[model samples]
Target chain A: MDEFIRIEHLNQRFDLSEPWLARMIYRRPKKFLDAVDDVSFGIERGKTYALVGESGSGKSTIARMAVGLLTPTGGRVLIDGQDLHDGSLSVAEQRRIRQRLQMVFQSPYASLNPRWRVGSILAEPLRVFRLVDGPQAEQARVHELLEQVGLSASDARRFPHEFSGGQRQRISIARALASKPDFIVCDEPTSALDVSVQAQVLNLLKQLQRDLGLTYLFITHDLAVVRVMAHRIGVLKSGKLVEEQATEKLIESPQSDYTRMLIRSAPRIHRAAS
Target chain B: MNGEKSAWQRFLASDFFYDFKRSPVTIVSFVIVVTLILMAILADLVAPTNPFDPGSLNLMNGFTPPMEPNAFTGETFLLGTDDQGRDLLSAIIYGLRVSLFVGLTAVILAMFIGVSLGLLAGYRGGWVDAVIMRIADIQVTFPSILIAVLIFGVARGLLPPDLRDELAITVLIVAIGLSEWVPFARTVRGTTMVEKEKEYVQAARLIGLGSSQIMVRHILPNVLSPVLVIATITLALAIIAEATLSFLGVGAPPTEPSLGTLIRIGQDFLFSGEWWILLFPAVTLLALALSVNLLGDWLRDTLNPRLK
Candidate 1:
């Protein structure tokens, strides 16, 4: 199995300290929060690798680092065997690596720019990557993207505010897919949507992945979502990757107490006798 | 075609338009501002006489009362003539043109400088943010008028004696622009800080767009609503500041008299028997400033979601 994306010994430390003057007056030492503590993971090509953790467990930090949005204090991310944060890489090389990956942010409300129309939003990545030629071609590509995301071509004329949360999330997915990326970092993509809407979005994501042969770095706190979406799961505890295994194997017989607790705590539906 | 029509209809039905229709003060002020701007732009064609031309001034027509024939020339002045014998209505019209021009150019200059600096500070934090914001903070400590006056004085002193009068308006615009930029920079910086944190901005960054591209393409649009509101309010302030400088005899020169210079000339005869000399131009300045201020206030309230 080829590793499509690899995060090696990643660490992120944020200085959470008061001003220098205040610290000196109070005689306090500088403080830091280790958000991601030397976590290492690799996702196989055409597979969903989910990172499960509660809030503040550094799930989003890893997600950000995976997508090259944040530079880690230590360690490096490699995409398709090429260093993503390599200072030696030229601008064109960096852009080439960046073009192969995209991010689907958690909040549909915040992810899509409010001022932009749906057409422009979808066209942005296409235009940036030079995926299409001419305005007519761009419009046609935008229309195709909208339809692929289960939206009408006419919907492209509307603003993000005019769409429902699920529809907006679909638009975000469409935008992520616009660049025709192989690897997508979905940082709790359905976490902000309705429970019913979440299932639909998850299904759409699964369908897209199957059709496109894409790899995913799925970040979420919900075990139920993990059970349904992840091929392999990495359970995180306070910035550390405690356990990682195949989703079913981990769910059936977890090695770590933390993984066991997580599985047990997840709500189950009782079957009714007919 | 149908979509475009509905979008237009939606705009007409938006809260902004609804608010505009509901408030009579906003309506009146909007009308006043539009009328004043149009009159200023069309001053050359609209005014009965070219007040700036020395050939057009008749010494015998000086101090002619409103709508009354002069005893010597039997010429009737609409608003009444100043001591210089320039037609008061025409002078007011031309004065308005100068004031509006200075005000507009000064605001544009301030907005350009302020928005750029603010975008830089907010998008690039740490030392870059610190340097820009510290300057803004220091500038904010002094009254804007004092800063304007200081800049105006230094600029005037540096210019050649012969060029002083010619460059006075340009210098005045720069001074007021420099003074007023603090507010715009401060506002934009605050907005940019918030906007830069948004996921959309992060998304733009993820696309390998340069920092400048993200700042200009993604973050700038998000931060512009407040900037526009600030720009509108600052226009009124810039106009008032220009007038204040001119009134102090440091602003627009006597040759090309702005409203402030007209008021200065009018004030000389104000204490004497010729009261209309002071009254008409003063009234015009008041109306222009007040209406712009009211329109700006309306815009601020309307555009700001917090206010709504």
Candidate 2:
């Protein structure tokens, strides 16, 4: 299998200690929180790998590290065989690495700049990356992006607040695609939307993945979402990966008791006799 | 999507304009501010005489009360004449120009300094945040007027004796500008701290946008509403501080006196019964400052998230 993305023994420890002066005055020891511990996972090209866990189980932490938002305290994150945290790389090389990766945050409202109209937001990556020449071409590309996300070209003139939750998520997805990224880390992208809206966003994500042949590291607490979105599932329990397998096999028979508990705890829709 | 509407129509339909229309006090305050500003700008055309031009003054007309002929020269003065025979109306109009110039310029200077420092402190937390915030804290403990006075004195003392009067207005502006910055820095730093944590900032970081770009492009606009509220209030404070400094004899020089200077000159003749000298300029200053304060108050309430 082509390892398009790889995380080897990733760890992220956050210092929860008081300020130096406060600690000195109080004579208290430094404290730390292990946000992620010895977690490892990989994704092949064009496949989605879902990391399912409860809140504070290091799902988002791992997602952040995967996207290079947080440098791992230990171990490595290699994308397309290039080490993301290697400081020896030139600034241009680092930028090239970043351009290949994009992220869609959990809260759609919080992820997009509210002050910017939809056109500029969608056009930003193309402009920054210098992918398209001139304003007219960039505008055309932005219109295409809007249409790709199932929005009209005219919607580009509107602000983020004008859109409903699902439409905003769609716009965000469009923004992530603007960079023409090969890999995207979606941190519970649909979790904040309504249940009906969630399905629409999920379908959009899946459709985008199929069309673009893009890889996704889908992080969420909902196993039901994982069942639909992921080809492979990694069950994370308190900063540790307890179980990893094909999503169908895992759903059919969860090996770890924690995974079994998560599966059992997830809500299910009961179909009436038909 | 309402994309077809012109920018003017969009602005009129916006929540800000809607709120402005709903508040009668803000409307009145805004009208007063606009009228005062217009009068100040058109002082040359509007004023009956040139207050600053010594050539235009007639010493014989001195102390003529409102619409009253001077007992000595039989010259009529609309709002009376000062000790120098400069028409009170023209002097106040010209003084309005000076006051508004100093106030607006000082506020802009303060906003620039405070916003830049605040962004630096808040975006780059740890020692930078601590030091900037500590300085702001220290300044906030003292009345801003005292700080402005101290700054004005130091600045004035630093200048050469020959250039002192020439640059006094600039020094005064610097003083008031510097004094008003603490509140802006404090307000912006707090807002920036909250804004930098928002996911858009994080996303900007992830996308290889540098710290400065992220702060200016992504975070700045989000944090600006609160800064704007602080700014409108600070405009009033800055104007009052300028007036206070000028009233203390350190601000605008005698050649081009601000409203504060006019009030200071007016106060002396108050006991001798030339009340128009004091009363006219004093009322002009009062109207200008009070209107700005009311507008600022309206802005604070309008922009307040708690009220929403």
Top candidate by lDDT: 1
Error of 2 at A68 (Å): 0.7
TM-score of 2: 0.96
Writing each residue's lDDT as its tens digit, candidate 1 over B1-308 gives 24556777988978888999999998888898899899999998999999889998989888899999999999998898988799999988999999999999999999999999999998899889999999999999999999999999999899999999999999999999998998788888889998888888888777767899888888888888888888888988988898889999999998888999988888888778888988888888888888888888889888878876
Off by over 4 Å in 2: A269-274, B1-22
Best by DockQ: 2
lDDT measured at residue A107 in model 2 versus the true structure, 0 to 100? 95
| lDDT per residue as tens, model 2, A113-191 | 9999999998888988888999899999999999998999999899999999899999989999999999999999999
Instruction: Write out the backbone clash pairs for model 2.
Output: none
True contacts kept of each: 0.85, 0.88
> What DockQ class does candidate 2 belong to?
high
| Backbone clash numbers for all candidates listed | 0, 0
Every model's Cα RMSD, please? 2.1, 2.0
DockQ of each: 0.80, 0.81
Interface RMSD, model 2, angstroms: 0.9
Model 1, position A149: C-alpha lDDT score: 87
